[model samples]
Target: MKNIKSLLLLLIITSFGFSSCQKDIVFVEGSGPGGTKPTTYTTKMSAKVDGVLVECEFAYAQQYTNPDGTKDIQIYGIKSAQSFILDFQNFKGVGTYNAADLISSGTYVSGVNDPFNNGHYAESGTIKVTTYNSKVIIGTFEFKAVNTIGEIKTITEGQFVISLEPIPGPTPGNTTTNITAKVDGVATDFTGQAAYVKSTLIGNVMTIVGTNGVKAITIAIYNYKGSGTYEIDIDAQGSYNEDQSQTGSYATENGVKTGKLIITSATSNTIKGTFEFTAPNMVSSLSTKKTITEGKFDMSYTTTTM
Candidate 1:
């Protein structure tokens, strides 16, 4: 969960990149509009110091297309700055990180810390890359901090490697179903126009469909209830679809999302549900279920903690 994309930072193969030497980076906070937009791209890197893991992330999900038409992602990071937050404050920087700044020219290990950020520090382990399907993953890097109080820390080494799949287009139905509703007892109209995507036989159980970003995405009503706890995560896939960050509605830190939804009411063309949010940064590894009978069947996802 914790946007474990940082673990899949398999850079280029040995033939496409420099020799197996230490890599240094010059991390610029932002390129243009300075906000949550990730300045890092196309590389993966991780660190483990002391005993904790200081995972670094790179925003390369928007880049690279494999011949099979999937996204082969890569992430990169900085050695001097393993984390973007400290001191009980979340300090998200403007970009990816630099490695050589903290490690020697050829060595794999590094000294990583942000002296001006939160007063927390650590000694980090080596960063490596692993290959999966059409993508190469990087990370499992650890950063063991000396101070745990008021600090952004990594307790263990974790890895999340997922291939960027293609989002199938909308399915065509003879009936044009419309849904209107208020969220969490609020009387506000839906934000963006919904998209009608044809559901792919993508997963094993849940016949997944639709996008849930700023765009008003039209998903085949999977589970509908008047009032209760619920959750959903909708996203575009691969280079074939537009980037979530570009629309500025990417859920939580990973751009995708995880949340609880509580429905208050529902009808023919109108429905209502209470929406709750969870940080998409880490995985969700728990079986939390809500039952709503007034609506249709149901759907769910597997996740860990953020």
Candidate 2:
């Protein structure tokens, strides 16, 4: 019994000695998602406010999928944001805003800041970010509006380069194609498709250039009135130049129209919805809302193990 007791005491002391001799440990790792991360992503975002062209950048170390199955972006509910300064031909500084001034302010909408009663901005409109990039070729860091005396103007549907970061690479999707524009019952000419689109994980922005005469259309998705589900809107160049003319023009097919796209359909690699060329106008003049009836777009996505 004494030997057993002694041995027990010895074991306890030995354990205490060993525990006291232990040292801290750590391990180094690779940057970002580590080496096992996927090279591509299936991305989507939403923005409110119709009849305007907004330019913003996105940066994210990760990506997300909304409950409604829509893709995710860095931020949403963009009231007024810009990415370039040179494009500010008509861009007036919304009153006097400092950087990061109105961030997270509130849900901004058209004519919200209009003191002029012109149904447009009463002063220089505010964008979340007002900066420039390598591919901006032209334009200022101002909000764009259709037929407004404000500094903001509309962008024809051609693709413009925004800033983004390059990953190792992505499984190249069709990056190039021609799409038809339908406003009401008129079929417009094919302008071009988004090409050379690179994703910037930092800013969470997707930058693309137009090809074969493709116009850049802003596909915005946002959660409004609820979560998961979103409201989608597309801003193109203009409407069918002569709505009644049998022949359509690129200007007509690729400009921003007063319309919204309700994402009624979605898939792993594609999103389908209604395209109404005239929305605000339909809401006012025709006492009607226009829907593309059979308009759809196929986009590519990359999913990874988060």
Candidate 3:
């Protein structure tokens, strides 16, 4: 269940990152030379859970291709601490999928605990795909899920519009990539012609760097998994370099005790998250410290093989 939650968080973050910059590609369902665009068509998700309204502020879908050529589509809707997830395995085009078939399932997470244990898992449900293509998917669903305690949550009036266009990674010299944060309560923006952002994945470790042509921020994760909160220790590290000449400040064993990296989403080509750390100056003569807070990054990446 922990792994399930982590994977869901990862998918949500990745969907948010892709939706932020590539919202321009609009797909008019059934539109042609004489067809009128429908006003209700938009990328969103809304439903009723246990007779209460749940209009998700964040929604997205992901498709995975299996080794045997079968496909799976997972839809997610998140609102604060609540989330609704629907999964359809061995997906075939536009059709109706029933939970009784064992190829489809739905989950409703109402709190921080595992949905299957504390929340709910679909006991009966049906998902109907209305429109589907290489770039877009339209669907509706309803289900009744029961938790380990026998409490049931009924979900209905669910609908969603998911985009499937690929999101491209930042180019090596692209200065428009963004990474922002606060240094001691001062806003610091890294973008435009003054900044450069990049990431590299080698084996199970991933390193991310952002520079403003002068100062720089670097974060390294030793055992890179999908999405979750990571502590700054020997496994995870962060550093802030003020200039090219100094040894900089680091969130290492010799530094202060507070530091964390929260990865909201991560994939083979993209990553998004928040971070903060407190570090003492590496130079022994200087007793100064550097504190970074409210740090955030959303950018594509490249990978290097072993």
* lDDT score, candidate 3: 0.65
Q: How well does candidate 3 score on lDDT at residue 227?
A: 88
lDDT of 1 by residue, 1-306 (tens): 222222111211111122222322223443566544432223434435446555444212223333344332333333332332211112121213321223211122232221223334444433233432333233333334434454444434533232222222233233322222333233222221121111222211111122223222222123323345444443311110122332222233223444444545544333444343432211133233222111221222221111
TM-score of each: 0.25, 0.25, 0.52
- Model 3 superposed RMSD (Cα): 15.2
Which sequence of candidate numbers ranks them by lDDT, best first?
3, 1, 2
Local distance difference test, candidate 1: 0.29
Error of 1 at 95 (Å): 19
Q: Estimate, for each residue in 116-213, the C-alpha lDDT of model 3 and write its tens digit.
A: 45468888888889988877778888899888888889998888776665433233245565688887788776641111112232225566666665
Please report how far candidate 2 places residue 158 from its true position, in Å: 26
User: Clash number for model 2?
Assistant: 45
Q: What local lDDT score does residue 17 receive in model 3, on the 0 to 100 scale?
A: 35
Give the per-residue lDDT digits (tens) of candidate 2, residues 1-306. 001122112222222221221112222323665544432222212232344444322211112233344422121211122211211222232222321222211112232222222232213343333322221111112333332443443322212222222222111234433344554565533322221111222111111111122222233231122112322232322222222111222221223444444545555434444444343221122233333323444443332110
Off by over 4 Å in 1: 1-123, 132-139, 145-149, 152-156, 167-306
Candidates by TM-score, descending order:
3, 2, 1
| Residue 139 accuracy (lDDT) in model 1 | 33
